[model samples]
Target: MAVSGGIAAYKSAELVRLLRKQGAKVRVVMTRSAMQFVSPLTFQALSGNPVHSELLDADEENSMGHINLVRWADVLVIAPATANTLAKCSHGLADDLLSTLYLAATCPVYVAPAMNQAMWHKTVTQENIQKLKSHGVIIIGPEQGDQACGETGFGRMSEPLAICNRLMDETPTRCLSGLKVLISAGPTREPLDPVRYITNRSSGKMGYALANAALKAGAKVTLVSGPVMLSPPVNADLISVETAAQMHAAIIGKAPAHDIYIGAAAVADYSPMITEQGKIKKQDDQTTLTLTLQKTRDILAEVAQLVNRPFTVGFAAETHDLEQYAKDKLTRKNLDMIAANWVGRDLGGFDSEQNALQVFWKNGQKNLAMTDKNQLAEQLISLIAERREYERGNKNTA
Candidate 1:
């Protein structure tokens, strides 16, 4: 599956052939503009199957074409996913054929974005990518290099072969077999009313990265998420919430049933106690919008306090003084460990795929340097595996 208006949309035919050569089924779905770059007949000949491009085709719906196409796949991958396509998938805004399939797909979804360096760097685009990850959508790459648009930086589609290999590789690992995990992600919206709210810029990237990595490791993952404009990850059970209160209710509802819990959501620390019924009109004088903010329930802390709590982890996105804050959170929140990073920098941790980490635990500390979030996420999960094992042993001995 490929989205529209991307220069790299032309490479998808070769992608189809490579998959067929590996003895896997091949199907293609393209957006309207993608047809402008390449013909559906080209892909149909390559895959030996009809190419799908529309959601509203009366002929196909009569035969249940989209549902049939959706059920036919072990995985759906979007190569050269345009930012616009990414946005639709991120927030359940499925206004196109590919987006509709993404919403309707029961299998794993992978997106390889391609665009100019500048468009990729825009905060909106990056945040949309994070939202998709939070939804269990595995992001491949927009590798940094020279582009077809004569610009250079971080906006190239991962080579088709690389995307195909990585998709196939998900079947081998059973790293987290028999492990049940609970994860929370995104920024909790603290609502003043149905129309207004307070929230953060947490695009939910780190948590989603961890969730995808956990799945690749063979864990049964449950994601309790906030108001992120992203799609649900493929194969993950998703619980959606808006406010911190709602997030708390969802977490408390499920925390006891899992073997591990990672509270990665940036829950709003405070919320407005009173809200105007309608839009507050402008005032000439300095009108202090006295939002009587109240503290939100501490999700990780509550989990840590449980009688037989699962291994708990937390994330701290800081702007300065990383070491102190990370260590403090480790002890204060009583997390097994915490991952901290200095946000608001150009190193690309927040809305960017590449991220760095300063992890703190009672036993030791480690500096996880800047790398692709997917790679870093795998490393983080490995560490969690060891930590979880050690804690289990310690509990049994006690």
Candidate 2:
């Protein structure tokens, strides 16, 4: 474990304790300025190992300690990685003990950044982050929250337990290998006119994360996405759609050949019964103008009713009675699984970077607590794969 200088340096102590509690043998290395925030003794006590802070300590370096540190580590994790540390590591500068280990370490490196929102958004910092990612560093959260700086956009380190869980889940098995996955994502627009439409704030992050996870698990992935600003993940075929009608048609056309179908899109429930050929002219005396609506295609229910349907997953974003509504939808639509989350809140749904999911099947249920969409997606995919295999076993026996 490496700790860099930041207000979040204090949090690293707890992180070390959490890692050790999880049976990880933790050896902590701190930046010089990090010692100012929390003494090296704190980490040493928690990690149960000598804290390394400098590259020139003769007692520790008598046996090429820097190289030895790199060799001893199975995985290197840097929490509270400040802007300076990120810049140094990104540019391959090995000026300090932590940065030196970053250069020398052969194992996978994970970084959790902590800084002010402004610092994180700086062009140089963003470029450095991208460079680190390009070099295969697993960049974890700078999750959105109230930062120590008292301003919040997205520059807070993830909580210690979340980081610990991710470390445990990082090396998951390729459980969905050789399967075909079809996923729907983003909010489907219900157009009222050429420029006006009804849609939810579904950012599509959850669905995109699922697609990426399935691809990582060696599944052939096809993502049918509604309008979103996100780029498509590599190796997954992307089909872009706009309106609910178009999304429904695309899914219907392509879902039959896939082995798994996940309808993560928040498809519009209704569309205008009569669309105006042109924008309706405003009348000076008009006080109320009413338009009728008709139900949009229920894509999940349609897929579920197929005679040779794929293993289908649905998502329900609810504002009230989350689990009850989710279970009702699951049974009513006859879906293989349903992942539900509460929307219309300040966090953990819709456009937020993190979310919690309550997954439901017929006789079983699991709660995936709040975390980044990527980790949540990985867990969801793994659960689906496990259930799919279990069903297969039961079918063979029957």
Candidate 3:
């Protein structure tokens, strides 16, 4: 494991401990800056091996530590991969031990990024992440939450347990190989005027998680996204749209070419009947103003109704009558599956980092309890793949 400089570097210690507990021989390599936050002795104690950080030493193996380390390792994991480290690796700069080892290693690589939220969101940083992904590097969570910098967003390294579980799990099966998956995400705005619009609390986290999970499961992914602050996953074909009408056109136009469609976007139910040419004038005397609303296109329902349509899944977020409403939509829209969850509660809903789902199909249902959106996404994707295979088997037998 490579530990880069970040406050999250301390977490890498626990990650090392967990990997040792999982019965894996461990080696740790650190950046110079990382040594400032955590001592090399700490890692050496936990890993039961010497920690390596120097690019050049008169010590052993002819001063070719980078080459020897790569030969002995089956996998390379870089935790708390700082922006500097990421940029260096993406651009093939091997001036240090960790970066040099990254170049020489022939093993599968995983990176868990850590930095301030702003740095993580920078266009250049995201582009570097894309370059790494294109080279087959698996990205673990830079999960959203409190940061050491007293700011909260998506730059925190994932918890050690989550990282350990992800690494220990067998490599993801290529179950959806040779299939196309279409996903919609985020909230669609319905313009009330040039300056104002209607939208929901959807953060697009769940949808984005699903897209990433699909990509890991060996599917060709096309993501139709509404306006969102999050970065798009690398390698997925992306189409960005804002308003409900535009989202509708994008999804419907692309739906036929895909084999599975997940309507995870929180599209507006209604839009203004008329958009003012300019911002509505405000008057000191004006107490209230009313405008007409027209129903927006039902993107999920329409896609489900397409001839020989892809297996379709929909999401329902509700505050009351959750099961009844979810089942009703599942039947009314002729959906193959629906994942419903509660909103307006204190936990696991829009804008939050975690979520839960009560998933239903025609004759069965499963409850996916509250968890990180990314983990929940993997479960959902596995279920979708299983159901699709079952449906195909039935058709062949019939």
Candidate maximizing TM-score: 3
Clashing pairs in 1: 90-229, 90-230, 135-232, 135-233, 136-233
When sorted by TM-score, best at the front, the candidate numbers are 3, 2, 1
Per-residue alpha-carbon lDDT of candidate 3 for residues 63-110, written as tens digits (9 for 90 to 100): 898888987987799998999999999888999999999987655578
TM-score of 1: 0.64
Could you report the Cα RMSD, in angstroms, for every candidate shown?
A: 6.5, 9.3, 8.6
Instruction: Indicate which candidate wins on lDDT.
Output: 3
What residue pairs clash in candidate 2, if any at all? none
Cα lDDT of candidate 3 equals 0.90
Question: Global lDDT for candidate 1?
Answer: 0.81
Give the per-residue lDDT of model 1 (tens digit) for 172-198: 355577898899998988767668888
For model 2, what is the error of residue 248's alpha carbon versus the real structure, in angstroms, after optimal superposition? Answer: 1.1
Worst 10 residues of 2 by lDDT: 130-139
Cα lDDT computed for each candidate against the true fold: 0.81, 0.87, 0.90
Tens-digit per-residue lDDT, 1-398, candidate 2: 99998889888888888888888899999888998899989988999999998787788647567788988977889998999999999888998899999988756578999999999999999999966754446788989989776787889998988889888879556788899999999998887787787888888888888887787676899999999877676568999999898998999988889999999998989998987778878899999989899999899999988877899999999989999999999999999899999988875898787899999998999999998687788799999999989888998999
